[model samples]
Target chain A: MSVTAAKGFTAAGVAAGIKESGGEDLALVVNNGPRRAAAGVFTANRVKAAPVLWSQQVLKGGAVSAVVLNSGGANACTGPLGFQDTHATAEQAASVLGLGAGEIAVCSTGLIGTRLPMDRLLPGVEEAAGRLSEYGGEKAALAIKTTDTVHKTAVVRGSGGWTVGGMAKGAGMLAPSLATMLVVLTTDADLDSAALDGALRDASRTTFERIDSDGCLSTNDTVLLLASGAAEVVPDGTEFTEAVRTVCDDLAQQLIRDAEGASKDIRIEVRNAASEDDAVEVGRSVARSNLLKCAVHGEDPNWGRVLSAIGTTGAVFEPDRLGVAVNGVWVCRNGSVGEDRDKVDMRYREVGITVDLAAGPESAVIWTNDLTADYVHENSAYSS
Target chain B: MSVTAAKGFTAAGVAAGIKESGGEDLALVVNNGPRRAAAGVFTANRVKAAPVLWSQQVLKGGAVSAVVLNSGGANACTGPLGFQDTHATAEQAASVLGLGAGEIAVCSTGLIGTRLPMDRLLPGVEEAAGRLSEYGGEKAALAIKTTDTVHKTAVVRGSGGWTVGGMAKGAGMLAPSLATMLVVLTTDADLDSAALDGALRDASRTTFERIDSDGCLSTNDTVLLLASGAAEVVPDGTEFTEAVRTVCDDLAQQLIRDAEGASKDIRIEVRNAASEDDAVEVGRSVARSNLLKCAVHGEDPNWGRVLSAIGTTGAVFEPDRLGVAVNGVWVCRNGSVGEDRDKVDMRYREVGITVDLAAGPESAVIWTNDLTADYVHENSAYSS
Candidate 1:
């Protein structure tokens, strides 16, 4: 419950009235002090949301003191008017917090195309700003969700006061390489923008981009990291970077856990790939496979679907080099159908399938949800 | 119904006793010579079935006269033993017809792992050979089905006496660049093996390769085109190829119409790409999107899903260069949300979406089925 437990940040969440449900949908967080160095990551999708556009430009200055976020509308594909709204929102937060407009980042997520309801949103920003406290991290996590049923937050403590705390939200429209999930991380540890930016990218490679159940990347995907220099010590190289990465990985798993209509959270691990990309490609191919998802949903260990999904990856490998295991049981080996397929079970809410290429030693893992009747029912009627 | 109507072949379909139902599960087709030319197309999946392995070798020789197919057990992943089964099947057919084993080919599709029930199959094969007729095309087509609910056949008559007639069966395990589909074509045209090969490749490029729904390429996919030379006339180059391609397109549509558990057949066309590959990459990207498929199933004109799928194609493009039309109604333009989103309806079984890249004049089309709850049920309990 304490943001300061991991060092340098205070956060707060407030009911913004921006959401129809009147649930908490706005948050503000601050990084007090000496080294306000920060780095930000934005969705690679070309159809950037208005907030992503504004924040990308703001982060170019290499530091940020506070962030303001609103949930309920993506403020994307709304033309030039959306850009204006995004800027005004950031400016209002900057002025109220007695900071430069260019020093405060912004993000928004929810339904796409609708303009921000500034009448209700502007006042909510003031409430969030007033509630900012060192113990407000949990509330901040609750304010960034759309279809998520639970809040997601993670904290990693390192040597000294160096710490990494992060939170994210997304369920549907999720694919890695920037899932619709939005994330914000703050640390008291001092680090250069280049170092933080590099670390964020490296962390995202396996964390955010590896969950491709629905294969849809959101326009508003963003993750920002702020280093407040509040921590007296900054661990070097792998030590601090790994700590930051652990937080991202933990939060990513939480998002997968909340995937829409998901009855099972499946961890698809691909081992012995010729390369990490190959391993990831193979894993993503299976993760995004609707047929394979159905197999998992039925508690049917249908590995043929698994092999079929792997065959789609353009990676070079003889079929005989493949091996697959489900729930710690080998179902295929030496490049042929394994005899123990019937022995595998998947009656639980969590399933794991380990695919071994047996061609190389590298490995990768992707998180996904099963394709269930409810997933079909929910998405089919979503827009209606 | 006459395979000889295309001029060069005879066909027969009989109960192979391979299927427990005792239905017709074996088919035999022979090229009546003169045009003993064969051109073959197989699945692109690296993990090919035993028949795929045999056919790949057969095509290398360029001279094939007959094909024997069964539909009770897919000779795949049975390992080296699987290859032996295919060889034995082909040799038996060759011996019964007084031909060399090299002149015969084999294809099978059904439950994986379970070996073919040959006690009943050997006699079924001889019975099928004895029943061979110049007019058994329909039966041959029907015998190769696994889960397909209907028979698909097409005939195209060109200038002079040349004609192309064929059959195909594919319902599930579908993705393109070969899904789990089988196609056999017989023609009386006097084209050489090279020309026949060229036409089949061109036809497959725009036909079988375009049906990428589940993104699960099957191991047993095969397409064989045989010229029997019964027709004295022979067409060459683009014109002949175009005729061959049209028949393929027609049968491909049939496959889509009968895709497993599909209620809607969706065509995603991408235009004005930087290159044809780029366009195809984008189109295929949309076809494989489970979210889009679910939306189509629900009759939801969710253009956001369309944009998100295209964004992941890795094809470089300006956001504003993109436009989307669902059922001929523009739902998005200039990368901004379109006003007609509420107007595009996908209630019908045939739904079309045109995605304009505006990058260049290259274009590609992908045919796919909308994902539904029934699809999940069908595949999940396939083993049951």
Candidate 2:
């Protein structure tokens, strides 16, 4: 269950004819709300897509009635015309749903530098609105996939029957500051925009923001949260936040598992840092090292590459005090070779690496994918 | 002609049995000098290799009689033992060349965290010294190759009958801050260590330090200059600097052209920046973009990927004021589609990308390579 798992939210997916393959490529979700509270976090990329720019302004109103998304064209680098297309799409959705255009949020995916096929997308929005239903969550999830091999959805039930659900689509161009993906969450818990913002931020910080699949940030990344207050249950802030985090974590894991052409889902945990930020900085450095990723793919447990990556970071650590473990084997200690690398088994699809800074008490974990021939094959053959 | 193309240098290469392939893996270059002034620069990586640390100390003496380098093991992360190995290699070279131990420099490449085979290496130093000749420059260049398919060398005859010649070897793990490579330059100009340092630093700023092949900086990157003053030519500082720059530019181009598994050598030129530093930053940001590199490999002029890479940089620029060109075709103008993309061609091995910031008058160029399946194949099959 995705958005429809929560009460007061209706969703639909439709074939927009924007995708040349003739599959479902448009999704619409509407909140039938008593309290229309909403919050959103968008890509930090200065070069944002058309929908991203429009949705950022719409999110400032602190209320959202619906969201329209398509997966055929990203509508980035199309200049003023792209922004106009996004505005018109939102206006079209507003007219059909009898809502204000400013209250509608829009998200887009697929190839960048191309304008959306407005002729096909506008009519498809109307078709999606006509088919909106509580059981359409799975279809909506399926419609937003570009290079994704599987659709992602997560759900959690909170106190007093309150529910949180989310759907996300991303396969590559994953980096910090949101990466290249779109996410939407719906909740039936009674909460204000302030609570939604706080919960959403907290959930994303340790989940979506910590993954680096390919170390390439996208211009269209977006995460949105909407509360309809239809469950009529005033859930505690802590419980609601945890529920949101659970869904985000699930989605993040799914993204990593399905990262394009990735043979190994690598978990990089950096511990004993001077600060939490230092831990993240060190973790991201290792996560982005192509050398380490290749070593993981080869099951070589080459911890020297890990040390080199750590050296690039501005983290507090003595060179000789650093330690590295691969697949639970401490292959390096005191920055020197320690255990036998052959003892580290990486035959599975998941690779675990832990870097000990031996400096302080802070820690962080970052998820990434290994560099494989398949990753290069998939990325090199296509433009998206 | 390589390092020995200069008037006062002799070189030799010998098989040290350090490489599993049983190829030549040890090199010796000696200066028959009237003046023995020397200058050196090493990897900026905080996790420096043992040879780098030792050579840094040796260069501080402003004199060098010879250099010993091995190509099968990078003496990094081996702790004190690695440092001892480097020191021993230098001492062995000094003994063979009849020079003081403190007057020798050392360098090493290949896999990290492994101690050199001192038993084989120390003996090989004497063997190489016995075979040293003015025509052994190419042999020394060949001995330094790791995964490189070629041996790089460049020579420039300068004003007043002086000459500058060099050799470099790097195929992978290449990035800014020197890359995973070893370079040696020799000159017969009558110059002090201070003059050589000034010219070497100025030449490298726009050459070796501006390339980003895979964005993995190695701990063993080094560039050293030895001035023997045997030509009896007191070359002008400006002329000497120009000759050094010529050699550096030639070697840098060779490195990019021969970058491991790369099908496209990409030149990223960032122009119209507020400052030279900003231009370099922006150029490097685009050069390191895997997405854009993959696009270039696909022969797709996807300027949107270029804009996305630029957005990640802190260089001064407005999104609406940016323009991008691929292969001299202006596909994007003022942050929007400018010309028909179908008009562009990308069938060549060399790809050129120019990003116009429209901010000011400064510019910089960074050389890089496209990501390919062959690259992944080479990097993932074994640890290097």
Candidate 3:
């Protein structure tokens, strides 16, 4: 169960002929709600896609009835025509659902700088709307995939009589500020737009915002949440927030595991930083180093690359006070060789690297993938 | 005629059995000058190698009698022992050259966190010193290779009967803050320490400082310039600076062309930026984008990735005012599609990408390499 796992939600997936591969490329999610509260978080990238621009305007009033996502054309850098195309998609969906266009949200992902196939997309929306079902969450999740090899969905059951579920689509261009990714979350709990917004922002800060797969941001990144209140149970803010965080965390890990061409998943934990920001900065610096990533892929246990990456950052730390560990072996201590590097085993799909700054107590964990030949081959094999 | 093209400079290359491959891995260059003025630039990375630390201390007096470089191991993160190894190497060179240890500099490159074999290294230093000759520049350049396929050298002639020559060694870990590189430049012009420092810094700012090969800064990067007044030519500062820049530019281009496993060399020029710094920032951002680099390698005119990279930077530019051109074809104009992407050609080793922010007249260019499968294979094939 994905978005439709929660009560008061209906979803559908349709083959829109948008993807040249003849796969399902259009998804529709609707909230049959007693309360139509909504929240959204978009990419911070200035060069945003048309759907993101339209959704931002639709979310201004914090009320949403439906969401439409397409996976074949991003409708980005297409000038005014792209914006008009997004408007038309929302209008067509709204007309089919007998609702206002302003209450519908839109998201698009695929190759940028292209106009969507409007003729096929508009009719596909009506077909999807007619076929919408409460058990169509898996289809909806599969339809919004570009380069993803598998569909990703997460669900969390609350202690109260409410539930939260989400579906995300991304395979490449994954980084910290988000990439060419799109996510839709649904809840059957009594909540307001402000409450959803606060919880989503807090959940996303540590979950979706800490994965750096390739250090490439995207112009079409969006996450939206809709609350229907069909369960008639108002959850405590903390309880509901924790559920949302859990789903996001699950989805984030799924993205990293399925990142394009990755051979190993690396979890970098930077502890003893002067502050949270410093910890995050240092962690990202190490996570984005191509040398370190390649070494990890080769299982070389090259901790020197880690120190070099950290040295490039502006974090407050003494050079001689730095420490590093691979797996569980402390390879470097006090910025010097500590243990035998040959003893550190790296023959696993998952690698753990810990950096100690010995400056303060703040810490951060950043997930990244190793750079490999297959990654280069897969990325260069296609333009998306 | 690398460093020895300049008068009053002698160099030698020797094998110390330091490299397991048994290649020449030790090099020495001495400036038997009427003037012992010197200036050097090192890596900005805080976690410096022991050789870098030793050289920094030696250069404070603005007089260097000789330089010793090794290619088998980088004495970095080895604690006090590493520093002592660097000192011992310098002292051995000074003894052979009949000079004070304080006047000798050291540079090391290759695998970090490894100590040099002093038993072999010290004897090799004396052998190199005994064989030092004005015609040994080529051998000296060859001896410094790590993963480099060929030796790199440049020579610039002065109108006043003086010359400048240099050698550089780097293959992988080639980033903007300098690669795991070592360079020794010698000039026969009449110049003091202050003038040499001013000229070297000015020349390097726009040349060596603008190339980002893999976005991995090194802990062992050093560039040294030694001046000898044996030619008796008091050339103008601008002339000397221009000559130094030409040699640096030549060497920098060679480094990019011979970078490890690279298939395409990309030159990103950001134009119409709000400021020169803004232009540089945007250019570097585009250069460092792995997705864009991969797209270029695949010969795809993916300007959307270009805009995404620019969006991640803090450069001041309106979304609609951005423009992008590849190989002189304006593929993206006014933040939308302009020319047919099919018209853009990428069947060449050198690719030119120009990003126009339309914010101001300032512009900057950053040289980079395309991400390729060969790069991953070459980098992961060896630990260093």
Query: What lDDT tens digits, residue by residue, belong to model 3 across residues B104-210?
Result: 99999988877889899999999999999999999999999988899999999999799999999995323443248788999999999999999999888787888
What is the lDDT of every predicted structure here? 0.80, 0.89, 0.90
TM-score of the A chain in model 2: 0.98
Q: How displaced is residue A334 in candidate 3, in Å? A: 1.3
- Give DockQ: model 3: 0.74
Fnat across every predicted model, in order: 0.64, 0.71, 0.76
Model 3 chain B, poorest ten-residue lDDT window?
B171-180
In model 3, residue pairs whose N, Cα or C atoms come closer than 3 Å (at least 3 residues apart or on different chains), thus clashing, are none
**Residue B272 displacement (Å), model 2:** 0.7
Superposed model 3: Cα runs more than 4 Å off = A172-179, B172-179
Please state what fraction of the native interface contacts candidate 1 reproduces: 0.64
Q: Tell me the deviation in Å of residue A143 in model 3.
A: 0.5
- For model 3 the local lDDT of residue A374 reads 76
- Candidate 1 chain A: 10-residue stretch with minimal lDDT: A171-180
Listed in order, the DockQ scores are 0.61, 0.71, 0.74
Q: Write the per-residue lDDT of candidate 2 for residues B1-384, one digit (tens) a residue.
A: 999999999999999899989999998999999999999888778888888889999999999999998899889999998899888888888877889989999999888888788898899999999999999999999999888889999999987799999999995323442237899999999999999999999998888888888888888888999999999999988989999999999998998888878999999999999999999998888887777778888898989888998888889999988999898999999898988889888999989999999999999998889888877777776573
Evaluate residue A367 in candidate 1 and report its C-alpha lDDT on the 0 to 100 scale: 86
Model 2, runs deviating above 4 Å: A172-179, B172-179
